[model samples]
Target chain A: MTPDPAAASAPGVLVTGAAEEEVLAAVVVALRRLCAGGAELHLRAPPVLDASVADRAGYSTSFPHLLGAVSRGGAATDLVLTPAACYHVYPLFEGRVLAAPAEVSVLADCHRQEATTERGRLRSFRMFETVRLGGAEDCLAWRDDRLDRLGHWMEALGLPAERRPANDPFWGRPGRLLASAQRADRLKWELSADVADGVRQAVVSVNHHKEHFGAAFGIRTADGEPAHTACLGVGLERLLLALHHAHGPTQERWPTHVRDALGLTRSCTN
Target chain B: MTPDPAAASAPGVLVTGAAEEEVLAAVVVALRRLCAGGAELHLRAPPVLDASVADRAGYSTSFPHLLGAVSRGGAATDLVLTPAACYHVYPLFEGRVLAAPAEVSVLADCHRQEATTERGRLRSFRMFETVRLGGAEDCLAWRDDRLDRLGHWMEALGLPAERRPANDPFWGRPGRLLASAQRADRLKWELSADVADGVRQAVVSVNHHKEHFGAAFGIRTADGEPAHTACLGVGLERLLLALHHAHGPTQERWPTHVRDALGLTRSCTN
Candidate 1:
């Protein structure tokens, strides 16, 4: 499991255990099942994003101050570290027409320069994401299905989680309005659980980008309409923290409900 | 599974299916078993490392031109994105005395600015590392045990792998000498496999730092002797590429032996 980035005592260090390994495995398998048979591939978005593309995608407008940039043969503002996992997928589909809705999943560490560094508020965090792209209605339906499936999985795992309207940590005064609008439009929903030290945090999210990415990347549906996109992502470290709070420091002492949900086997460990 | 960074056909992307999930899970469990029931905890190193630490760790000496620095607060060179997964462990042990031999494991993405973007050389790649710190003789023994265990895992997975003396892509003429010395001392041993496009690449490395890390970080063993350290790490993306090369593109089509070693169960995926 990933470590708490904000915990000053343990900031930016990962410590994993047997139960953590099991949960990580269980999470990956469950997410794959939700992908509806995705062809697994690996991706690493250029750690630095193209400033112009990010600008078109509302990155600089949303959080101009938080970008982590590199001096890699571009203007100072030409590139910034990617802020989101799904963003990279859109670029790959640039100018492409989908034959059908495609589902892709990624397990990668995302970076952000946040104002807060509280334990668990990681600067770089591990995430397992399932991203679906296609028709507007199909994407929406898939999002709904996944949201429901995630709820069921967590319930079986004995992780007390609640899905509620949420907003990204967008920046500044303008960001406040954007956040509120996002909440009002119900563009995002997070499955939040109590984590280390009884602090509440969002462990999973179901996000719909409507036509933002499709228009920005010039991606279209099979019928030549702007593609709709929805992404479901689980914060691996946060999930482990929630499990630790619920089951104890490790998985060995986890309750039968939790253990059953993880569905661990002897082959998984002794 | 992640793709090769250098491969233009699938640059900077990771994809996985049910079988791949099983493989990753299997690898983790296998590694843990090799740890001989490591009573160790997981740690997450801060993603952004202090530039001075990287400098002192001989990163600048090794690759002077390929550093990824952040323009966020402080001077241009004060901080940088972490380039190696094991570097973080050494700093944490600074000014500390180990009661006994200690071992830690990390699963994190390491950054490098590779001049050549080959299909298999990822600029930002994920690494799973096991770092052992203790007496010179004990650490060496542990390192030997790990190297042998790794060989067995690769064979069991049906990957034709060979261990050979290796050198880092050190920079310039002076760095060339360093690389030669490293190989001469048998400091770095890589398990090479034929990956993407039948190119032989390194997937695992067992590195013995001797007292380098201990001396740099001021870490002393129980008897006040500078500790010796060794790191065993797997480049997950490269391994995945090798698996794809040998087992075919989709994990579903992989051989029974491959699937079995992954310990795939219906419970893991239907």
Candidate 2:
């Protein structure tokens, strides 16, 4: 997502802007550094996905009420607004077996029909995601490493957020059990920061799918066994909000290291 | 709209990425330079719009078949996916008289349910828009200046494009007449680029709305007269596509000025 340049220097309400660009650019640089040229970075994707694909991916079961349908010709088509970035990526590698760990970094526009109009909790938001697919041990290692990388990096930027137990927004009743299982297995962790509203917001998450996507999409390892997968997702807008709250409204007030990385010098947010 | 970084350097159908970032950044720089510290820059906006707002803005009538509705609890809410960046802006100043020429730049994700799977077109796309609201003369000058500025800058970057009389996508049969009127009156001008498909696609558009928005939204100019407005919208995806088609695949092959402007030095696309 391109940050709004006009609001770049100010703590104005516009989510991502030029002032936040340096931060986002630094994150991208970090992702690239982590990739070390070993992972493929992907930014190209459509906003909507095939309904059958989302259904098969368990979106309907997980977020049935949240699904945003794309109507075509006065009727709902087979297409659906993408609920999560990873949902689209897994289907792309359906029926494929990886000889080695394959990694990708992608930015996706995630859409959801929410009942709440809470600040920083938007129906449509951007997600910067890094995904790894391979054997279980390797995937777990990558996920854990990401937890460290993200936590440390946030602290370094002075937006010290904590990685805490997290849960997915699954559907009506059974979702309660699935969510419990998720937290029990420690499948998810959130990087949370206190915003101006005095509420801690989860701006980033690390998730280990443990062959969930692999089994559904038939993505296999070299041994022809279901692969394991892990994903790190950064809610870009929320992160920008947290940063604005932490670093005042102007980019000039940010640390020189942060500005140096983003290569941003002009300070008009005054 | 951010491009997948994997496909960023290479034009492999992903809309936004590292390459797009450089161009988008350059655009932001240009907007700031043009604003010259007087214009108020805005970056925060949600991806969706209220249905009633869209209705008052004439979207429900013009793009009746194209509205993307958000259904919750088995009923359609007042929310509709935004169709254009400017639609939401006009209502913000409804019934308010500007003290002077008010200028603003905004980036919005526009959603359109297109039937074509054509290249360079999608269901949802990003739009970077610069708008001016003032008296008729000032508004026209601002719009014309935008034409000159945009044309000169694109040429400076070596992405030479032509400006052609254009028309909006009005609704059904009667829309043909309305579109013809729009073109006849020179209400819109398009910046077109010749892509790999041997077809010219409009990457940007300059529009002059002489009190249409003001009258509809009750926006007023100084002295309490209906305000005249103009908008310059750059379709970031289409522009990026044009850049790829013009400069060829890899960033390394790009001109030195273009590369320098974007601060792009990496060349893994080889």
Candidate 3:
């Protein structure tokens, strides 16, 4: 359910899927359309597994430990391009926080059950009230937070998001905090309803857990919630795989839009 | 010219190089030495250039049509990896056949010229050869064309090379040919003495290129006409760079063997 480019005129869809084959298939279809529409394409590096986790996986048998540990044992475990940082958003819980209003009733019902009776227990969570945006901005500064700016950016682009208080699972609870904000940062923008519709369709076929094993989950958008609360994750390696599938394996045929998005066009020799 | 690894075995020097910074640096010092021996390291990647001539440049912004381009119009170009064919070992020239002796001589001289040329010129030349080694039994039947057993296995390993002579300027000549081969269709290997020393050093760098390039170049040892003839190379992205340099922009510490050979292990990782 990819959004129609004609309706939203959004930059091409950036998808992160479970397997290389699945993502590659989607990229091929997107590339065919983009080529026909004269859009540029770019491929970003794939999302890698956390380095610490890779070391624990014992991936050194097939390849040299120095090489195999870094190359495999992660999300974007291919042997082509170098690894780059891309933020994977996840809810960070500290204490207790509000649930989306729509989930209140359901959550209340679940909370009423005894811990031993329920399949899962309800837990209290806390999140940063605001997040930072751009360079060097602190998370407390709402003005600089992408979540706050997303509405305006979408509106400026003629794709206004419905504003409403909602829970941000990412940064809303205690999980893993990224070492550097840049590696955890992403550009958050509103998806047009038309585009959202397409995303919903595509999401049906995509396995939510496949993108980022324990970090990624889906949120239901209620009738009055933001048009859609999507975290535009930037998995560097996943992006590369997508691009490889969209365009040919060669970098020459990459779409211009994608190249520009990643700033790969900046001349750098191998 | 490449230093003889077998001769330097007691001192056991492995020289390697690549067209990448991290890879070159990483190859010199890995976290662990899979194979124990001292290695002399020479790290070199083609420098980034805006423009250059067809024969001497290593990189370019335009789609190079001649002299085996590495970058095509700002995109990295794919080098063809050929399988070890009988024709590669004995090249045909002007209705005459040049046996192993002539083939080896032609390749050696070409390598020397390419190595002595300006750095830019060396970059422009796409001189490489590859060979696939499987189980001892499979390697024995490599000469049989009917059963592409080795070639098929290499392709299965993700390297898809053809069992024919390459069509590069270095190998396309009537009397001259570049002896390039690969273990898998994707695992590209070359036989050259020009940057053989640099190549061998790169393997020891523990850099990313060791795996990314999977390139190993060497000259036959039976009749070493060229004094400094034997060398091996790996890729720039496949080596482990973290082990070679310290926590700065420069290399701070190289491995003990590399330190002794290059006399600079205390460099930064910059």
- lDDT for B258 in candidate 2 is 70
Poorest 10 consecutive residues by lDDT, candidate 3 chain B: B103-112
Over B112-225, each residue of candidate 2 has an lDDT whose tens digit, in order, gives 776664667656777778778889999888878888877876786678889888998888998889899989988898888876567678887998888888888787876888
lDDT value, residue B203 of candidate 1: 91
lDDT of 1 at B116: 66
As for DockQ, the candidate ahead, 1 or 3, is: 1
Tens-digit lDDT track for model 3 on A171-243? 2123124212322343222222222222210000000111121212222222222211122222222234334
Task: Between candidates 1 and 2, name the one with more favorable lDDT.
Answer: 2
Cα lDDT tens digits, model 1, A109-147, are 565666565546765666777778888888888888888
Top TM-score: which candidate number? 2
* CAPRI rating of model 3: incorrect
Each model's TM-score, in the order given?
0.79, 0.85, 0.23
Regions of model 3 farther than 4 Å from truth = A1-137, A140-233, A237-251, A266-270, B1-249, B252-270
**Position A221, candidate 2: lDDT:** 98
TM-scores for chain B, in order? 0.86, 0.86, 0.22
Which lDDT tens digits does candidate 2 get at residues A5-49? 323111212334444655665556665665324555455455566
